[model samples]
Target: MGLIRKTLGTALAVAAGGAGYLTATTNLTTPLSADDELWSSRSFKRFNRHRNPSIQDVCWKSIPLSDVRPELRENEEALTMEFCRGAWAGYAYAPQRAIMSITNKGPKTENQLFDEQQLASSKYELGTRFSDHFEVVERTRNSVTLRGGGSPLEPGPREVDGLFVISAKLNRQAGTVDVGLKTVFFNSAEPTGKKPAPFFVELLHRYYARAMVDDGARRLTRKTP
Candidate 1:
């Protein structure tokens, strides 16, 4: 829990329910890059940025945390987000409950900035991210795929709620990241794994999926502020 701090605590603390609808009653300037699926939802204000790599720093508000538990909130509250300076992840558009993301927000450098290793990948946001660098796999409702690098950080089997989760150890070799997900027991035994990404980044993607929608212009605001 070394990464645990106030900001990160708050990010993970915010959970989500079913797909919440944002009203589109009024005409607004939609981003040209807005994806069709995202444009159709109320949760996402913009669609194209949901998966951008250059976007590192982010700030959002009025997120969907209505159904989250106080225990979860408290658990997340203790973490500081400072540790995430390296690489961070977030949702650019309002993705369906089914789709999520993991971003990169590490120190700015040529290799860090230029590497968009995830472009060719599809499905299983977490696995496809860094699978090329570590032993990572994904189990989606449709398929179970593997995307791993030659190097594997062995994590003994661990269960969270009767499901296997990505337990890649962080703080290993510097600049090295590992992450996984609770990929078992979906509609199918096999989930989708595109690749692997940094460990802390996995946290960012998972939590950001349920994080706040930064674009208020997309949401239906009350007459009063």
Candidate 2:
């Protein structure tokens, strides 16, 4: 009986150790702060955005925000043009996987379009057929906020409503920019009263978020000449 108990205890210890390692490596916890501005809006439903029936993924990076801020401020047209001109080629999930197009209904003159007020209302298409629409909702000398959402490229019976906010802060003195990207996906197919998405799906989202942040950081570093 003593030997049997020892064997069982060793097995339990190994299982616990493995579980701890998996948790550490996966980083499955949500990283959002309660004070983020995104949570302040009345339209921003916390339950719909972060809890059951929705999946939120966040990605962040600290790089040379100055390098990217210029393009972001240059105007919606210029930003879209740069993205299409291959500035973001290396950061895409797959080779030539994503494409963007802009529709500037605000102004015809380039100078006027660059004005922050005019740029806020511009619309963009992330894929061939309006996979996402983007707008510059807020901006300042040191920060910019873009809000966007649309259907997923993947087809399924489930209807998806996604809202994303990409907030960037530049610290020129430190030569670093901190970018926080938050995406919340709401699925209509989920039965009423159902729980959040399965663990594996959330895990994949976390990995994808990390990949996006890493890729953006790499691209920014490469452009910091």
Candidate number achieving the greatest lDDT relative to the actual structure: 2
Q: What TM-score would every model get versus the actual structure?
A: 0.19, 0.48
Clashes of 1: 36
> Which numbered prediction scores highest in TM-score against the true structure?
2
Point out the worst 10-residue segment of candidate 2 by lDDT. Answer: 109-118
lDDT of 2 by residue, 73-182 (tens): 33434433323222123343442233322332223322222222222233323322222333344443433333334323333223444455544455557866655456
C-alpha RMSD values across all candidates: 20.0, 12.5
In angstroms, give how far residue 118 of model 2 lies from its true place: 22
Candidate 1 deviant stretches above 4 angstroms: 1-152, 157-207, 212-225
lDDT over C-alpha atoms for residue 45 of model 2: 53
RMSD of 2: 12.5
